[model samples]
Target: MIVRVFGFSVIVSLSALAVAFLYRGWTGLALCAILGILEVSLSFDNAVINATVLERMSRFWQQMFLTVGIVIAVFGMRLLFPLAIVWITGGLAPVEAFRLAMNPPPDGADHFADGRPSYEAILLAAHPQIAAFGGMFLLLLFLNFVLGNRGLTWLSWIERPLGQLGRLDQLAVVIALVILVVAAEYLTPDSTRATVLISGILGAVTYLLVDGLSSLFQRRQPGGPDTSSVPGPPDGDCADRTDMQHGEIRSGEPARARHRPAPIAAAVGKAGFFLFLYLEVLDASFSFDGVIGAFAITPDPILIALGLGFIGAIFVRSITIYLVRQGTLGQYRYLEHGAHWAIGALAVILLVSIRVEINEVVTGLIGVAFIGASLASSVRANRRDGRHAHHEAVRTH
Candidate 1:
């Protein structure tokens, strides 16, 4: 079963390595492999967060994420997105940006003589805006999870209080804005302060637009409150409740497939389309970190696409699908919560990184630590429950 789920990722990773080796020999192959590993490590939490959303999507959309989504992940974010940034910030044409990326000038090269900042320089200069955008988007996501009036919490002391306050709509937005202000004033350079603020505002707006569109597309049943409005709690255990209708086929008893809960069916039509858009935007936001981080390894666009884009993204998609199919979220009830917490930490890190250079290794380690801790908690909870169940059986006997 594990082989079936991850077979494609394995193939693609190996293929990327082979191609990299052919293109630039052992050095290229090693860099690509390292970048691939870095991407996966930095984004494991991304996979967990993605599974929470992907499981709600229909099978068709799930397939779409694996298919069309992979193209966007690789070519769009990995390849073109950097060029687009260069075009926007440097006023360089796409062809010129592509040229610069392919043949980046040495650091401190004269712009007039060379006709542009080195790709690395331009990318570094653009970090303020990138950080503002991606950080705000992720910050909103974390705030929503923390502030939502959901009862479930992995870290009860902190999350429980925050969850209670979540009933106040727009509280998250307020907090996000305050954080942005602090980032702009204290963390961002004076020259880039306005850029960071504007980008962060736009990020917040983009998040709202996508979220609103998704809500608009959701299916509404007559006489029932809009289900989407009722925010799912921070506890990862809440699977879609729609599957409960099936019950047990043979025994007329409650069906408890590995103690998994039924998930709500994803909305189709316009709703599905917007949900798809939401997923893509979420992906872009996630990719911003990887794209920026990859520059520290090598400024070669093609290699970045091969390593982080092709290999890492394929694995993330596979992991998302595996989590959904295996009902892992339902089983490891705190995993989603842990992922969100990691996201919040990453958001802070991105914002801080605009001022201070942080090693990609450290960044990756932070995510892994959060996820590992969550998995440990999940296992402990399972054992505790097992003991209780055994005791109950003993009493009944």
Candidate 2:
């Protein structure tokens, strides 16, 4: 399995290099490799969350996800999305945008007709749209987390009537529309107001559409075990027997055989896909910040791709695997929570970058700090639990 995974990764990397070679030879290959790495690094948490979801999926689905999903992520989101945004915003045709991006103006020419592409300069150019995108994204994330923690019942008063109307999804649409209007009226200036509004609406609509699709897909899959009914171990020796019996029951089945998912499993699967989409969008949001920030380093698209792509992808995949197999989540439940909160913070940073500037390195450090703190807390909890268990065992004996 490891060979297959790495083999596929090598094939993809080589294929990207081959295409890059066709265009710009060593330079292109170098660019692709770098951008691949950048993308991987920026999206490390995304891969971890993806693995969490993948663990619950059928082997077939897992294979499909790794193969097809990576393509979409690499090409569709990373490369094409930026080009599309640039085209739409710069008022250049698609081909023209590609050309401009691929062949950026030479350094010392004042590409924006002002000065060097400083962080302030890029932030000034991208702040409005970034702010809009980040603001709405963070707002939704905050609401989702808060409401989710409330058991989603707090929403019952609002959702019940909407549910009866069979248009709860429309509520999100409405909020997005309101945001669109507000952006048009106040957030965006006359020069770029239309573009900002369009992009904001696009982001919101995309979010709702992706969320709905993920939910639907989840409804179609088999469910998993009922977590609520997962009884605690029986007292004394019977506990061991019960655990053994459970192990025996599970061992009786073939690993690859299809089984109807229990409700909890189904919910988890669905939640996983939702998270997958969230991570994808979140990665894109982070990339937007990085891409814009990269211009400060160098606007040469080839260099950006080279520097960010290859190195980024490898680390991200490693992190994902570490999160997935190490049972970090199961062992340190709060770690996932912290990561998600970091995502929320990053989302806000992306939004705030539209109006104010924050260094990408700083952004990364903030997330790292949160993750590190969560990890430390989890480790402490584990040690404490271990000591408590020892004490209990001694007392019982």
Candidate 3:
């Protein structure tokens, strides 16, 4: 399974390394390699969140994301997107932007020749707006998930209350707006207040538009949303295993429904078109920090962008495939909970970073901590349930 999934990723990574060597010799190769590791470490939770969505997609769309999406990610987002930022913010012509990108300034230098802003300088200047948008979108995602009623959870104490409040209409939006206002008015600097506020609002609206369209598209499915096929602890079956354990039956649903394969709603069709858009937007948000942060290593825009795909992008895609293919969510029931919680933390960190510089390592560790704790909790629950099942079998025998 590992080889089948990661074989392509390995090939892509090697090719990228060779390109790096050819482009700038050993220095480019080393820097690109380090950036790859940095991206993977920082974006691990992104893979988990992405798997939750990808599992619902049909095979065609899933493969599309793996193939075509990689090209878009590498060239469109990694390469052209940064140049756009530099061009727009720094007021440079497209060709000039491309030229300046090729000749990046020295490390930590804000400007290059004639005191013009460097590509990195423009990106840093744009960070506040970037943070505002990505942070708000992610914050809303976390809120929407926790607000839904669910059977399995790692942090019941908090999640339970949020779930209870879910009945209120658009409660997540109300809360997000309030937080955004507070952050913009009080937290952000006076010079960038309007930009930050407007960006944050755009983020919230974008989430609503994309997510709402996805749900609307989902309803276009012939039989409605296929909620019954995923045989996990969700829907109140088992906290650690499939609900159909020991031939047990869930009332109101056929045994075959639980036994059916992963729910594939034809993502290549209308049912998944908007969902695909949502995933792309989510991927962009995940890469926002990494794209900006790569400057600390080297200012060469070409390497910074290509470096992401060298190893990081492919590995993330592969991990998402593994999780869905292996049904990791069903095996470790609280994984979804962990991933969402980590997203909430990351959202807050992104917002806070607008006022104060937060280390990327600190951001990564916080997410890992939340996921690790949830994994431990899930292990305990599984062990306890297994022992109970064994005792019940012994008595029956």
TM-score, per-candidate, Cα-based: 0.90, 0.67, 0.91
What CA RMSD would you report for each candidate? 3.6, 9.0, 3.8
lDDT (CA) per prediction = 0.80, 0.52, 0.78
Name model 2 segments beyond 4 Å from true.
Answer: 1-42, 112-127, 150-190, 193-198, 224-279
Candidate 1 to truth, TM? 0.90
Query: Order the candidates by lDDT, highest first — what do you get?
Result: 1, 3, 2
Sliding window of 10 residues with minimal summed lDDT for model 1: 248-257
Q: Kindly report which residue stretches of model 3 are placed more than 4 angstroms away from their true locations once superposed.
A: 106-108, 226-268
Give candidate 1's error at residue 227 in angstroms. 2.7
Cα lDDT for residue 84, candidate 2: 70
Q: Put down candidate 3 lDDT per residue, 19-89, tens digits, no spaces.
A: 99999999989988998888888777889888888887888889888987887777777888888888888
lDDT of 1 by residue, 260-331 (tens): 555455656666667777888888988887898898888888899999988999999898889988988878
The collision pairs in model 3 are none
Q: Write the per-residue lDDT of candidate 2 for residues 153-218, one digit (tens) a residue.
A: 112455335334433434535554675576567545688787677667667666666655555665
Q: How many clashing residue pairs appear in each of the predictions shown?
A: 5, 30, 0
Angstrom error of the Cα, residue 203, model 3: value is 0.8
